[model samples]
Target: MDNEGVFVTKRSIKWLATLALSASLPAAASTCGDQGVWLQVLGSGGPEVGDQRASSSYLIWHNGKARILVDFGSGALLRFEEAQAKIEDLSAVAFTHFHVDHSGDFPALVKASFFSPRTAPLPVLGPSGNHLLPSTEQFVTRLFNESSGVWPYLSDHLSGNGAYPLIPHELASNSTQPTTVWEGVSAKLSGVGVNHGPLPAIAWRADIGGKSIVFSGDMSGRSGTLEKLAQHADLLVAHNAVPESARGVARRLHMPPSVIGTIANAASVTEVVISHRMLRTLERKEETERFIRDSYKGLVHFANDLNCFAVP
Candidate 1:
């Protein structure tokens, strides 16, 4: 049977009915509400911008303090500012990969750091480098080093006299399993490898104040890596770039709705937030939700720009 036909099957129909009923209720705000650990969707769109979803960036707040900024994609800086996010409050920045759509805004963010009064060097984390792709350390250095790069204005600030500094940290390529890459402010950042061409991809799992949330950074389908890292997370933010009907091209770099559902089901995450929507998925939101609901029995939410999810 074709994918569309399967979605209309009795089981899927019942699931959709349940989803319709559940959608009427207010969604859970957060996993740690009193502790103030919350998630803000800076940009919900993918590489393409149709409905103004801002690529794939998220801001995580711990105890009303900005603990981490995850994946600063293109135009994310604008979205962050629009959301009233404090760039200086960030303890660390974690990049899932070096894709233009995901990490393109890093240089701009670094330049903006100069205007802030940050005394400590900002820690930036990402995968190890290869000949083609720069490691997290090299990526940051190339941007601010005195020799060459785009932001020469940052040279003085990066050097002496209480300038804004960036401390680069590279996550070992293909680490055996998920491990802590950065930890502070009652939060821990850990990651697992994901398939996104030869560029190398990663997914982050953060534990903030005893609550956990996972972000799947553009994986190739529903792999065990995602399930293992996201296992039992309070919220699993999965990418929904293509519909189940999409094939070939999308299967290589992105996951369809069904794939996301299966992974969320396997991980047993309490809630599944669909993000990174491309032009196609943005126009067909209901279709994507129905496709995912067919296999996954959990709360499925379609995230939008600036939408905040409060952690319990």
Candidate 2:
């Protein structure tokens, strides 16, 4: 419950390319005779400026390949490679929010991918923007396409040679129920908006094979849609950024361990993985676990960078 393996072989790489090209996406990568999906904690820390750990990020590996990336935070690209996750195997990325700690390493990832031999397009899903922030389309364009973006060289990545296309998807920030975002050979993705103060954030759920993993992202305890999206999930990846009951302004945007525990228990999740680890939460692991254990009896694991959890 507190531990996380990653073994890659030549056969796996061959299968990865074959799968990536043949199907263009996973149809039931989890449902086949294969084992199940694997989730890796690519980043374990939050926005602490210059922390040693990576920021909030994760990987959803199916059929022995890292196919879906949950976030692209600072230092995550390094961890992603450290875990031996091939850049070419990634099919899509879901950004819970645009917070630097959650989506900061995107440019680095793209830069790294340029060195790989990938030909397929990479799909990106993000929350709809409002007056305060840019929508997913605007974000991607401004970051990689528009002339005003930081990286002017990436403007034509979506349709140019020697570049894997970046397909951007902007989800409605008001969605409460799960809406299918992407479907692959073995994976089906869904997104549902959750309250996160003024930030337009959303939680993501992926069903691979037959098992399910729900990512709570960052949420204020008020969203009941999280429970619905997480129902009967095999694993619930909840952020451990706040305390048991959270205090002050943090309470308005982050869910405490108790609230997270209740959501997992109510949804009858088989396991819970606490990530997006912050200094306060990391220092008070025992206290945080105690509050969570009070409501959820299932296994609870505090995540660390590169920890891989098998989604069974």
Tell me the tens digit of each residue's lDDT in model 2 across 121-216: 888998999887778888888887646777878776754654677888877978978999888887878999999998899899988878899999
For residues 108-213, could you state the per-residue lDDT of candidate 1 as single tens digits? 8877766777777677888887877888877876777777856766766457544556777777656647878888757788987777656567789889878898
Model 2, residue 123: distance off in Å is 0.8
**Global Cα lDDT for candidate 2:** 0.80
lDDT minimum window of 10 residues, candidate 2: 25-34
lDDT scores of the candidates, listed in order:
0.75, 0.80
List candidate 1 stretches off by more than 4 Å: 1-13, 27-35, 156-162
Clashes of each: 10, 12
